[model samples]
Target: MKHLTDNTLNEYLDHTSDERSRKSVKDHLNGCDACQTKLEELGKIFAELQIVPEVALKHDLTPGIMTRLNLETPVRIWTRTFAAQAGVASGVLYWLASQLIPFVKIPQVSLSKAVFELQSWFAQLLTIQVSLPTWQIPDIASLLPKFNYQAPTINLPFSTVHVISLTVTVIFLWVVANFILLRSRPQVQR
Candidate 1:
């Protein structure tokens, strides 16, 4: 029988050899003292590797990696979450407006009339005889479901101006709220 080579012994010890190769190495090892001694030395080296502990990391690298990779910072994500929340809130408010605005009693044939009239008044003061387009203002109330309930009516004046102004205010509030929300969050250190 041929003597087992160092590669064959190492492969057998590492379990990388196929069944036939391992069987051949084992058969040869029984008769070859030199190969057996080499196998023992390899085992001792492997044992020493486990006996000594692995070196610890020199420094924490996760933050540096995240920054260099241009990954989204955790703080921005958390802060911008409020923008989504504000959008949801706006949707709820619009739904409420659709529902509750119908309850307010008002008489109207057109809603845009108020805005046109205002434009005309401004034009008249400027001595421009503006042919303002006739539009329905304060008439959106008619589009809403009629006040049929016997509940105590919250009698409030309804007009295109009031609703338009409020709509603008809400929109402005949403923008400011989001801007402030992001700015108020603490800066994250890399």
Candidate 2:
């Protein structure tokens, strides 16, 4: 005869076993000392587990969660008016630097001339033309659609002062924005 299973023993100890199952376990336990011992051990363990103290947290973590979720925390007021004024000053400085910087005579670059030189150098370095042996190559120029592509002339007359001013303006705006953002959030104490 099969001895009582752990599940059967546990259910028996918990008083949750069905009548038929309980009867089978009781009949087995009558002859089996091992099953009776196991059931008593499990019952003691269950009792201890039921009596273990429930843990209580010292601090509530709901506010931190709510702040991260942007649900409960109110949007802080714009108190950094001085920082905003500094950003305006920075913009003014950028405009002043652009105007006050002495003009330097910069050599203008012709893109068409550069392209022609590059093409000549490549042509001299590597021959792209194919000289096939008796394979009557169909004229690709005729096979393909005719393309007359003239690259648009892009002339950006940006001086050194213009470049510096542009850089300063971008950096100034970025720094000011970061300062305002960092100062705006309310510091949560742990």
Candidate 3:
């Protein structure tokens, strides 16, 4: 026959055992001397524990405990904001690329010119006709007339240098903006 478990004995002692459990444990204890002894020992321990006085804490240890556990440490809000901003910036750049794709004209080259250019490129020679594909912003010139606005004619020759400069400027501005955002955020307390 299986003797009463420690949990059963404790539950019986604490009066937390159900009526059926109490009756079953009582029957087992009557026939089992080992179970009876174990129950008595548990009862004595419980009684002794009840007499012990509860002491108040001298210091609030929650912060120290949480710090050690690192459970309550707040995440840097700027990191999330920076990631979201980067995603949005990338999306805008992609949209701008799509809008400009229609205007980009890859100049048709003759077979002789193409062969010469390829040979020159291989030889690392100058006088290489670097015809950049022309790209324009979507129908802004046409839209201006509909809106009764005259588009300003700026005679700035768009080249690879201009595109590179524009890209570098945008990246520099984005970096500065992120740096400012990071610095402006409040520091998390330990």
Q: Compare the candidates by TM-score and give the number of the best one.
A: 3
**Candidate 2, residues 1-190: lDDT per residue as tens digits?**
6777887787788789799988988888889888888888888999999998989999999988866767656655444665677788899999977765544333454789767767775665454454556768756454443333345443457899989999999999899878975786555432
The CA lDDT of each predicted structure is: 0.71, 0.72, 0.73
Better of 1 and 3 by lDDT: 3
- Model 1 residue pairs with clashes: 110-136, 110-137, 111-136, 111-137, 111-138, 112-136, 112-137, 113-136, 113-137
Off by more than 4 A, model 1:
54-163, 166-190
Q: Compare the candidates by lDDT and give the number of the best one.
A: 3
Please provide TM-scores, in order, for all candidate models, with all chains considered together: 0.39, 0.33, 0.45
Report each candidate's C-alpha RMSD, comma-separated, in the order given. 12.7, 18.7, 14.6
Total residue pair clashes for candidate 3: 0
Candidate 1, residue 176: lDDT: 92
List runs of model 3 lying over 4 Å from the truth. Answer: 1-20, 30-34, 47-79, 110-115, 121-183, 188-190
lDDT of 3 by residue, 1-190 (tens): 9988888888898899899999999999999999998888888888998899989999999889966655666665467656887898899889988877666665555778767656655555343344445783454333332221233343446799998999999999889977976675555443
Deviation from native of the Cα of residue 128 in model 1, angstroms: 29
TM-score of candidate 2 relative to the true fold: 0.33
* Candidate 3 accuracy as lDDT: 0.73
C-alpha displacement of 129 in model 1, angstroms? 34
Alpha carbon lDDT at 86, candidate 2 = 73
